[model samples]
Each structure stands twice: as C-alpha cells, then as structure tokens.
Target: MFKDLLKTHLFPTSWCPGCGIGGIMAQLAMAMDEMGLNQSNSVVVGGIGCTGRMAGYFNLDSVYTLHGRTLPVAQGIKMVNPSLKVIIISGDGDLASIGGNHLIHALRRNVDLAVLCNNNEVYGLTGGQAGPTTPQGTPTVSSPDGSPYEPLNLQGLLKTGSRYFYARTTVYHQVHLKRCIKEAIQWPGFAFVDIASQCIENNGRRLGFKTGYEMLAMFRDKYKRAPDGVESLAPLEIGLVKRGEEQP
Candidate 1:
C-alpha cells in the first residue's frame, strides 16, 4: 500500500547509498499511506537540499521551492485552499538558516501545516558545510577544525509559541519516526517534527563514522523517549510537546 504513495519509477533516488534521507522518505510515505492522504487532498513542498528531492518522489502533488522558501510557499498554499493538507519536507539548513525568519512567523501564526525537518546537522548537498543545527566542535568540510558555534535551539524556539506542537525522533527509530509524522499531520495548528537523521557520506564520515549503519547504531544507543507528561524534553530525549486547546 505504501508503494502506491511513492513514484516507484523514480527508484534509486539521488540520495547516496545508505543515506538516511531514503529512510525518512520511506517512513513518511508509509505514514501518509496509513493516513489516507493522497494526491487529491495533500501536497508536499520541498526546499533546496538533498532532503528537498523527496518531494519529487511522492505520488502526490509537490512543489520545489527556492532555497529557504518552503515555509512561505507552503503557508500560501494553505491559505489559498484551507481544505487541502500541506506538508513540508526540508533540511535543517533550509529551515533553520535561510528560512529561519519564516519559521518564526509560521510558528507565531500557528498555521495548519506539518513540517518534517530532516535534521542531519550539516549541509550534505553543498560539500558538507556547517549548518545551523550542526553541533559545536563537529568537524565538516567548511569547519575543518570543528564547528565553533552552538547548534540552534529548535525545541526552545518551537516551544516559544502559546500553542505549539513539536516532536523529536531519529531515523533509526522506525516506529517512533512514523508515529511522529502521523501525529504531526493530525495536530490542529503548526506542527514540527525534528528528525535526527544521518548524512553518511558527508557529516558521518567527518565525524569518524565508518558507515551509515554505524551512525544509525549510535542514534539507537544515544537517544531515548522521555516519560509521558513531561513538559519539555532533554537533549537526549525524544517525545512530543504540545500546549494548546488540549493538554500536552
């Protein structure tokens, strides 16, 4: 059934062998499949990055927007046809860097949109540059010595709104990742799902990881779900946080 949601003819996506973007795409497709979402009711908007290519693979209508413009475009689409479901897929750099101003306004407006950010931490497509979400001291092509700045506080930023929905999950956590996508799609207002994913050929190798599987193993060991009812999540915890008409 999930295969029906994908343009399987586009098999062997440009994403590198063992790249986590493929995993994110598959899981998202599966989630959409389970949700009864299709070409008639939904659209996927992608940004400029490896993750942006995901939009092309979806069987549903998709928009390939300019760098960092996915949000505003998605917002426009939502505003024009409030009945259609708009979902955005983009990388950390696209969303947190160039598109940051839009991210803030989108959160403040609490528009009915679902954003799935592939937080791989580095700009994988453009020669592995340090991105906004790249952790401090992480080595990259641009930061040969290591990134000197702290990563963006996405959780804190998302939580700034009076009513918000944020969920954190990693690509390695298959079940959780799909669940996060599904729930975010169902959330009434703006929903952001920060998906910690691997950029094996770029970020992973620079971090001394031998393979994508190794990176995945590290995620499996390093992250865990927070207890239910927690107001906020810690750096290593993965869970949902909401403040709206219904309790978190």
Candidate 2:
C-alpha cells in the first residue's frame, strides 16, 4: 500500500549514491499512509535544492517553488484551504540561508504546516558550498580555508523563535524518524523536523566518510540518545524538545 503511493519513475535517478533523502522520503510516505492522507487532500511544497525534487516524486498535490520560498508558499496553501495537509520539504541551504526569514516568521506566526528540513550540512545542490548550518572549520567549495563561523543549531534556534512541535532525527534512526514525522503531522500549528541527512557525493568525499551508508552509521552512533539523566552521556542528543497548542 505504501509503495503504491510513491512516484517510482522518479527513482534510480538524480540523488547521489547512498544519499539519505530517499530514506527520509520513504519514512514520509509511511507516515502519510498510516494517517490515511490521500493525494486529494495532501500538498507538498518544495524549495530549490535536492529536497525540492520531492514535490515531483510524490503522488500528491505539490508545488516546486523558488529557493527558500517554500515556507510562505506552504503557508499560503494552508490559508486558502485550511483543511489541506501541507508539508514543506526543504534543504538547509534553501531553508536556513535563502528561506531563513520566511521560516522564522512562519514559526513565529504558528502557521499550520509540517516543515521537513534535509540538513546535510553543506549545500549539495549547488557545488557543495558552506551553508548556514555548515559546521565550524568544515571546508567547502566556497570556504576552502574552512568555515569560520559556527554552525547554527536549528532546533535551538527554533526554540527561541517559537514554541511548537520540534524534533531532530536522522535517516539512520528509521523508527525515531518515522515517529517524529507522524507526531509533526499530528501536531497542530507549525511543526519542524530537521532530518540530519548525508550528501555522499559532496560531503562524504570531503569528510573522508567513504560512502553514504558510512555517514549514516556515523550519525547514528554519534547522535544516538542516552538514558535519561545518565551521567556522561553523549554531548549531542536528538528528539522532541517542544509541543505547541492543541488543535481546535
């Protein structure tokens, strides 16, 4: 049933070998299927980037908008129908760089939508440049010497801008990723999920990760959650940090 809804022709295609976006897409499809949302009432808004292509690959209503413009477009769609299940699939560069202002405003307004950010660190669509979320000292095409500025903590950033359903998951954590997407869709008001993805062709080569699967494994091991209040747990963690107003 889940496979029936996927746009299979879009597969065996563009994304680099081992890219995590495909897994994220699968999780989304599963979530939608579980929720019983069909093409008639579902709309996906994608911005310019690798993630943006999601609009074309789903068997549902979709709009491929300009770079960083998907948030507003999704918001507009929700305003027009209000009943439609709107989802925004965007990349770190498109969402945090070009579309950052819109993202923040949409969160501040608590618009009804689910925002999925494919955060691969570097901008993959455009020649592996240093994006807004690029880690400090990570060298990229544009930052050959190393990215001087600190990377933005999207989860932390949104915490200050709005109190909404927020979560950070990765393709490596399939179960958690699926649950996060489902919760984001079920939550009323604006919800954001930052999927820490892997860009095999670009980031993997630069970081010596060898393959996309290796990158996913690294993320899984490094970011996995520890037991609550466990002493000396990993410094980084992933999961829901906030919940918004109940649906009216």
Candidate 3:
C-alpha cells in the first residue's frame, strides 16, 4: 500500500546501518503518498551509485540505468508520456560529475521532472574516492593528503536561467526533505533538490565521525535556512543562489 510504500521483502537494504539514504527514501515515499501519486504513472529513475539503489526499494515503477545516465532516461520517459511523474534519484557523483552536461541541458530545456541528488561528498559506491563535490582538504582514497581542488558549486551552476526550482535539505531534516520533495514534484517545470546525505561507511569514517548519528548531528549543526525561506547548505545558502533572478 502507498501508506507503507516500501517493499518489505527488500528489508535490510544493502545500505549500511544508520545510513541517511533510508531517511531520504522514506521522505520520498511519504511525499508521493501526500501527493496521491499513482504508482503506475509515477516513475523513479536511478543511476549507478548508492543512491541509485533507491529505485529498487520502493513499490513504485522504477528504472535503473547506467552511471550518470538517469537524467536523460527520465527525460525520454517524460517526453513519451507527459502525464507520468518522473523523478531522477542518484548520487552527486553520478549526476553532477559524469552526467553534468545532461543535467544542465535538461533543466535549461525546462523538462518536466524532479531530481533528488544525494550529496554525500565522496563517491561512497566507488571505494571512497573524492568526487567533484568533495570539499577541499577532505582526504579520500584519491586524495589521501586531502583534496586540492575546491568543491564544485552544483547549485550555483544551476543559477543561470536554467533551473526552474531548487531546494536544499539534509537527511537529518526529514520533514523538510519531504516538504521540498513535495514542492518539487508539484512544480510545473524542472525541479532539483540537493539532499546532503551521509555515507557513514565511508565519508563519516574518513571525516572522523565514528557513527552515523554523529554525522547526522554534524549536518544539523552545519546547515542553516536562508532568510529567503529556502534551506541552505552551510553558509552558502545554496537554495536561493539565484532565487527569482537569472544570470546574464
């Protein structure tokens, strides 16, 4: 039933215990339920990454595609059936790194879809390597001495007239996550929600957070909401980067 939304048989998912992915999944399920989405007409498209696995746990119709390819696939599905509600869920590495081109164009074209980007900083599925979103000075498998490059500002990248709607939230704030998801789903054009999820097995350990709860608390401590009402990513205020304004 939509009330539960999850497939109990898939209980004990592959994600590590206390992983924030579960919280994001629950919020997603609840968002759909609140929206009264029809399972047959709602689609969850995922790419090859830890977040991609989200498509399999839900009872709704879902499609799993190659790494960084979720956006194009979801776009095609939306084109074929405009009535269907399409959602692209994947890790930051999958969407903002390798598949960044597709993401930029899709939003620029005003494609009717929702994107849920799980930003765990490092590439959790690929041996804890530093990804495009990994902050500078954070050590990873690829950068044991700490990453030298500054993290990519994905939300800022979308600030140019391309993005129709955008929001930021963390798994620690599940209620806000659901509310953002609900708003994004209801938006008429392209919508993006960047979820600062935690990778307890990798990122947390590397960053010195021994447990998932500590990581969650860290997020709660770090994140703040901008005065404009959209959630912020630390001091960056990612959600309102270009709220109601466009770049030249």
Candidate 4:
C-alpha cells in the first residue's frame, strides 16, 4: 500500500511536467516504506522551495516552515522528542542559500537528522534563479550571462564534523538514490544526501535540453559509481562516502 503513504488525491502535482522532483519524492516514499518510517515515528520538515512542497504530499506528520527556518524547527522537534526521526526535505537553494547558516551550525552540532536536498542547481520555485549549488558559468535568470560564483561544496561542508555521512546521487540512478536515503536515515549523526536532479522546465530548456529524458541521459553518461572505501567522491563520481556509526 505504498499509495497510502502519499496523498494521491493530489494527482497532478503542482510541479511542472517532466520535473525531476517527482522522482525524488517517489524514491523517498519507497525508502520510508521499506524502513518502516510512518506517521507515528517520523516527522518531515519542509523548507520553502519547490522541494518544500514534498512535505505536504506525505501522509506522515510534516511541518512546512519559512525559508531558512526548516533546520531550527527540526532542531526543536529533535530536542524535545529525541526519539522521533526528524527528516528534512528541501532544495539546494533552501538549504545552501538563505538557510545556509543553519546548515553549517547543524552540521557542527551533529544533529541527528537526515537532510535530503534536491540539488537541481536552480531556484525552481522562484522563476529559475541561480542557486547556491549552481555551477560556475551556468546561466540562470539571476545569472543570465552565466553564474559568476563557484558552487558550494556540500560534501566538504558535511565532512566538517568528525563523524559524517554524505551521499551523492542523481534521479536517473533510482536504485542508488533509494539506498542513499535508507542509509542516511540510519546514520547516527548528521546525514545528507545531495541528490542531483533536473529542472527540465526552467533549467533544461534554457540549457538546450528538450525533455527530462535528455537530462536523465546526461546524468547517466556523466556520473559513475565511486569505488568502495573511498574517502572522498570525485566530481563525476556518484556513491556513498561515510565515516561514522558503522553505517548503523
């Protein structure tokens, strides 16, 4: 009954057709169902972004907070009810830009939360602006001439803590994506899964991609699974890099 976990009544999601967020949402639901994360034991915190809408589609307890406020509110819930699994569903923009300070502090404090960021590289909800994770020289509404700054190092940020779990995956790699979600939820300290996804409507079209299939093909051809026991992932590698809690 996986359908029960999602609000299927809202058939057509607000997200544009061919958007990658939908795949991300489905992967999360499958993982949660496999791990027995239901309304009673888990609380989802959504940030303000296209990804934030994911919180409402879930049947479990969820909170949709203001921009950049998702982490603190999740912290409150974790502090008060330590037993509950506080998972955050947000975008790169929400977690790395306006909410970046909270992200840094949360990592430093080693909060027990699984943060799933849809690293689509653009602010999809706000008319396709360049975001924190957008690569340099990439054009967006905000950076029509190409992004002027380098993308944020999310893996490095996660490693700032002594014990950390960071996973990098893309929507095209569905199996790997689900595995990452499960491992992240099981991590002891702060766990982050940076899911590289596509914004076909806003970003892909501008980049000359005609459809989501083309974007998926790009990911498949570009990213490869990293070797086991690797300390860090390469730019084109897609794999798990964890050093903490023995992957419990």
Candidate 5:
C-alpha cells in the first residue's frame, strides 16, 4: 500500500531514454516511504523544467511554481503549515542560475524543508543550453566552441551558507541516494541533497556518452564517496575552502 502511493502515471515520461531523473524520483519516493511520510503530510514544490514536472507525479500536495522560484514558494508553504514536510525539486538552471539567490537565502534562514537538486549540468528542457554547473570544455548549443568557465561546486557552495545536513548523490548509487534522501528528510533544519542526474540526449551526446546510465556510471567511478571525517563517506565533499582549513 505504501509503495502504491509512490507510483506515478507519468511513466514513459518525456525524458530521454535511460534518463536518470526517473531513478531520482524513485529514490525520493522510497525515502519518503521509509520515513513514513504520507501524502497528507508531504508537499512537493518545483520550478520550471524537467525536474519541476515532479510536482505533477507526486501523490502528495504540490505547487508548480514559476521558473527558478521553487524555494521561495516552498518557504511560504512551510511558514504557513509548519507541520507539512516540504520538498523542493529543481533543475541545475532553476536552482543555481536564476534561482541562485533563493537557494542560498533559504539555507541562510534555515527553513525547515528538504531540497533535491537534480544537477544534470545543462539546461535540458531548454534546447540543451550550457547551465551554471556545466563543466569547462563541454560543448552545448549555446557554447558551440565549448564552455570555457568552470562548473559550480554545488555541495561546497551549499556548505558555506548553512549548517543544515547536506549530501550529494548520483542516480548510479541507488542505495546511497536513498539513504541520503532519508537523512535529509529527517534533519530538522533545511537539508539538501544534490543529485548528479544525467541529461542523456543533451549533455551526454555532446560528451560522447550514449545514454544517461553511462553518465551516471562515470560519476560513480570518479566522484563516488562520502566527505571525510564522518564514519561513512558522504556521496560527495562539502564545505568551502577556509583560509587555514585543510581541504577535504
């Protein structure tokens, strides 16, 4: 019965074949189930783009906010109904670009909500443009000559503003992803889980990867590990480079 609630008719989604977004949705639903959060107590907030469509699929209350404004909308929901468990789902461009301010401010205020950032490294829904997290030298429709700028370190940036529980996971690591979401949901203050999803049709093809699963596998091979100091290695590193602090 609990699992049935997580199923969404949105299957055979618009996302490209093997897109990691579906895996992310599954993990989130599983986490909610494990935490015993039902539709009555849960509310999903989302911004524009493929990630934003998650609001339509979730069985719980949802608000499909304007582009890059999910966090602010989520804040309002939490403020009015403190008992509701709010989860904000957004894409890379939505969260780290136009909505960047809202993302950081939400962390500063330490609002009681969970953030699930699907970092696909490109603006998938918008004709495959180079997004804020696009790595250097990655070719995109906007960057025909390859993007020159460095990618934003999402986990590190989030750690600088708030003291909330933070974790970074990938669709490849299903167990870790599920565990991270569960932990973030349980944390009292604002919690964030940056999911390294794959835009197979956009970023993947540009990088010579055939499918989203391949991209997820690459992330697992390269950056799969917990941050240092904790008994368990976090999915990715957190915190900024302090003046005298040792780098993780």
Candidate 6:
C-alpha cells in the first residue's frame, strides 16, 4: 500500500543481509500509510545508530539528531508545531543507553511522539558490543565471559506513568508489528513501540542462530498471545497499556 512513499533509489540497503532492521523499516512505512500520514506533514527524527539511518532512507521530513538526543529534537518539533506528527526511530544503545534520561523525561511529560526502539540486544554498528538491552549473561565482544548486569525492563519503566501507550513486538510478527505501529501513531500522547529486531551478522551469530530467519522462527516458537487478550508472551508483555476507564 505504501509503494511510492519510499526513495526507491536506495533499494538494496546497506544493512547486513538478513538484518530485521529492513523489515521493521518497511512496516513503519506501511503503518504510516494505514494512518493516511504522508511526508507532507509528518516528521521523523533519528539518533545515531543503525536505526538512525532510517531518516536518510524515508521520503519525509527527517532530522538526523545527535546520539541519544532524538527525543529532545522530536519534542522541540512538536512544541513548535503541534500539527506535525513526530516519529523517532533509534536503537537500544542510542535510546536506552545514551539517551535514557531524555526518554524518561519524555514519557513523564507525555510528549506527543511515536517512538520505535529497535532493540537488537547488541551495538550492531559498533562491532557488536553489548548494549543496554543485552540480556544478562549474553556473550559479546565487550562481555567475553558473559555480561554480569541485568537489562533494563523498558515496559515496566513506561508503566510508571499511566497516560501513554506502549507495546513490544518482534520483526517475526510483521502483521502484529504493523498494527502496533499504526495504533502507536494514532494515540494522542507519547507512544513507544519496542521492536525486537535481529542483527544476523551480530546478535544472531552470537546467539547460535545462523541467520535472521532462524531467529524469527525462534521468536515464533517462543512467543504466544496471552489469554487476557491484552498481553502476549514474548518473555514480556506485548500489548497496549490499558487505562482506568477500560478497567472492569
């Protein structure tokens, strides 16, 4: 449905073969298409990382902000003109490590922004180093003996403030991913979508998966929709945050 919106000349992207970043980027375009949003009034702000390159690829008003500063730039744009739809696309290291403090304040204020966090668990662009979202004990170039620290529970942190929308999805579930993106865009307050994308060259190989497809299969096998209908089991909840008005 979102055919012409992309800059086709950039086809065959620079992302490593089988990297889930490409699929998540495509679904992002599809979600905008579903929401009837176009480059005319939509703005995309990205931080330094593999995901940050999305700004250069999409045919929209884009701003390539400094590392960990994507949310501040987005918030500025929203403040200047509330009419524009501001979207942030960045990675775990950029958003959670370098820009974590900004993320916390943005959620606390409930800024009108659509944020997509591509969590590949490792710093893919920088030699596959362990990142903020890297699971405990994950062997990486930086953690030869396995990481000793726990990863940040992003969903739990977001739940501390009740006004915004939050959901988590994997690139394996393209349909659900696109749907979540669409809903996040339509929401009035700040919206966050934690996308578990795979870096075949980086994370997959280290995790014993030869290719990103195998990682996708692993996700499909490991995750399922929860019985409550509002949550899913991907080792964490992957669904919309329910408000008090919807409570039984």
Which lDDT tens digits does candidate 1 get at residues 1-248? 99999999989799998789888888999999899999999999999999999999999899999999999999999999998989999999999999999999999999899999999999999989999999999889999898999999999999997999999999999899999999999998999999999999988987889999999999999999988778899997998888894733
The candidate 4 region of ten consecutive residues with least summed lDDT is 239-248
Q: How close is candidate 6 to the true structure, as a TM-score?
A: 0.94
| Reference-based lDDT, each prediction | 0.93, 0.84, 0.83, 0.92, 0.79, 0.84
lDDT of 2 by residue, 1-248 (tens): 77766789777757878988999888999999999987888988899999899888888878999988998888888999999999888899998899989978998888888988898999998879999999999999999999999997686667764366677788899898998898888788888898889998877789888898899889878897644333222335667766436444
lDDT of 3 by residue, 109-190 (tens): 8787889999999899887999999999999989999999999877666666644577888898887788888878877778
Measured by lDDT, the strongest candidate is 1
Q: How close is every model to the real structure, measured as TM-score?
A: 0.98, 0.94, 0.92, 0.97, 0.89, 0.94
Tens digit of lDDT per residue, candidate 5, span 1-248?
A: 44555545656666778788888888888888878888789988989999988777888778889999999999988999999999888898999999999988987887878888898889999889999998888899999998899987676666675264567777888888888787778777778787888889877888899877688778778774644455233435431111211211
Query: Which of 5 and 6 is the better model by lDDT?
Result: 6
| lDDT (Cα, tens digit) per residue for candidate 6, span 134-216 | 99999999998887799988877777775757788888889988988887887788888988888889778987998889988
Model 1, runs deviating above 4 Å: none
Residue 144 of candidate 3: its Cα lDDT? 95
Q: How do the residues 1-248 of candidate 4 rate in per-residue lDDT, one tens digit apiece? A: 66778998987899988888899889999999988889999999999998999999999899999998889999999999999999899999999999999999998888999999999999999988998999999999999999999999999888886788899999999999999999999888889999999999889999999998899999999999999879999997999898868643
TM-score of 5: 0.89
* Each model's backbone clash number: 0, 0, 0, 0, 3, 0
Instruction: Tell me model 2's lDDT, rounded to 2 decimals.
Output: 0.84
